[model samples]
Target: MYNLPGLTIRTISVSETNNNVYILTSKTSGAQVLIDAADDAPAILSLLADAQEDTDATTHVSAIITTHSHWDHVRALGEVKEVTKAPTAAGEDEIEAITVPTDIALGHGEVRSFEDIELEVIQLRGHTLGSIALLYRDPRGPAHLFSGDSLFPGGVGNTEDDPDRFLSLITDVTERIFDQLPDSTVVHPGHGNGTTLGAERPHLAQWKARGW
Candidate 1:
């Protein structure tokens, strides 16, 4: 659980892959955005229900955003959306590859907002052409990034040994993320524990040198 001034983030790990499904709820309005319905609708629904705890706010998911088109990342997309019926969104280039239809085709630099919540889309090309990470800059605290598979604790996501893909991904993550955001930024990745930009920033050169 990550609590900010007006926003609360909850994560559930599901499937054999240990995919982290995130639920971001506005503390006041309860307008929510479900990020990566990785697996298990029952688990995802329970996470949503838990969002209303300790408050009278009526929690409802406004949108479902998939960070990329990878199968493991979107295993539960169909069921979750079928039940919640929330509009789905994905990066423009990866939308067609997703199993479920995406209602919002997000381009780079678009701010996806709902009531008091706003998430800026940062295109992280390479892991997938349309791979992306969402940035939530809290008004009262450090920023949070939903990095998906494009970034992890040690390095960028896999590029299948393709130099071009790796370069594209690392470059975007460097310029668009590391360069623009603060070191206090907390990264919530898709399949593992979180990390701070401050912790990983020092290894940027190492990752580039290792070519992974």
Candidate 2:
């Protein structure tokens, strides 16, 4: 559990794919929002149960945000949604690939609030037509980015050998994420460990040159 003044971020790695399930909770209200119900239904539910202990209220998940519709990213979405009964949200273009119906179609610059915290949506293409990254800006600290699979520690997501897709992803990451956000921002990717923007910023040229 990562505790901030008003929020807590918890990460659970699931399945053989090592998909990362993120649970963002509001400390004051105990409102919770889950991102990417990845895989392993039993494991995911256990993590949710542990988080619920922090609140005396109903402790139900208010919403489930699916970063993309990739099979690995949503393998357990339906199961988790059944248990939590939380509204499911996903990018409009990627909705067709999701097994569960998307209650809300998120797009660029859209904001959704859970308790006192607001998450801004950023549309990033390449990995999929509607890949998105969620941004949470805390008043006292630097911003936090749930970058889905659009970014990772060494480089961006797989482009399937498409140069055009790689270009699009690079442009979006530069203009929409890197250019606008500070280097101090913490990035929690869809898989693997988290990294700060400062750590990955200097290697942009290397990533671009490698064309991954």
Candidate 3:
């Protein structure tokens, strides 16, 4: 749970994998966006329902955005989308893998705005070719990054031991994420818990050397 300036963020873990489903609601407009409909329709629905307490106006999910095309990240995509009737958005390169029809194809650096919140898409390749992270500039404090499976606390997402893919992933993460963003940025990962860039920034070279 979070009480940012104009936004309210609520996250729930679903499925055996402990996949994280995030609901971001604009306090002013009550526009909601569901991130990574990972699993358990009942739980996902409940999370959305619970988010209503954050705003005065009617809280409606305007978009269901997928971080990547991975099975764990999208298991409940159709059901959640059906229940909410929200338009879906995903990385442009992942349109085919995601299966669900994506109403908005997100590209790197593109700003996707719904209601008062605007998320900037950042493409972090390798865990999956089209894996992406969404950045929200909070204005009040540190920026928040919905980093999906591509990024986590310890290191980058699994590259399956392919050195080429691993390099591609690490390179993108180092440049697009570590280099561009500040150390205070908060990273909300696809699974497990959250971490800050400052906590992980010092290990960039180590992560690269380890070749994960």
Candidate 4:
């Protein structure tokens, strides 16, 4: 129940892998944003239904945003889209081959306005070629980050497929995300529990020491 100024962000856990699917709604306009449609159609559908119920009004799911296009992150996207009839948005590079209606092509430092809230997209390419994270300053809660598979608690995203690319992703996390946001900012990662920028900073030295 993180209360952002004009937005309410709810993190819903799905799948055995514990992937997090976020439901963001504008408190002022009731516009909905779904982040990461993980591999569970029933769970996602149920969550949307609950959101509509709780809001007591028909909430339009404006977009289904995928942090990346990996199978684990996007398995339920088509079903969710079919059910909600929301446009799916992703980084151009992330969903290269997938033919989905991309309402927005996110890039580094791009700000997307959804009703009353503004979401800043940060490119984080270590976990995948098109991995991206979102940063926003909510009026109710502290600044928030939706860090897809780019980051985690006490660890970083796995880059086993490409060492050089992994190193670059780690660097982006350190400089772009950690350095850009305040210590009080809350990080809601794609997988695992939430953490703060302050809590994750102390481990930066340790991760850097590992030499990617």
Q: What is the TM-score of each candidate against the true structure?
A: 0.98, 0.96, 0.98, 0.92
| Candidate 1 structure quality by residue, lDDT tens digits, 1-212 | 98788888999999999999999999888899999998898999999999999346899989999999888888889998988889999999999899899999999999978777899999999999999899999988999999999889999999999999999999999999999999999999999999999999999999999999
Global CA lDDT of candidate 1, please? 0.92
Off by over 4 Å in 4: 53-57, 97-101
lDDT of 3 at 123: 97
RMSD of candidate 2 to the truth, in angstroms, is: 1.2
Per-residue C-alpha lDDT of model 4 across residues 6-70, encoded as one tens digit per residue: 66778788888999999888766678888999879898877766666445456788788889887
RMSD of 3: 0.7
Query: What lDDT is reached at residue 145 by model 2?
Result: 98
State the weakest 10-residue window (summed lDDT) of model 3. Answer: 47-56
- The sequence of per-residue lDDT tens digits that candidate 2 reaches over residues 101-212 is 9998888999988666689999999998899999999899989999999999999998899999999999999899999999999999999999999999999999999899
Question: What is candidate 3's lDDT per residue for 1-212, written digit by digit as tens?
Answer: 98898999899998899999999999988999999999998998998888788789899998999999989988899998898899999999999998778998999989989877799999999999999999999998999999999899999999999999999999999999999999999999999999999999999889999999
RMSD of each: 0.8, 1.2, 0.7, 1.8
Residue pairs clashing, model 1: none
TM-score-based ranking:
3, 1, 2, 4
Model 1 is weakest, by summed lDDT over 10 consecutive residues, at 52-61
Residue 189 error for model 3, in Å? 0.4
Q: Predict model 4's lDDT versus the native.
A: 0.82
Look at candidate 3 and tell me the lDDT of residue 73. 88
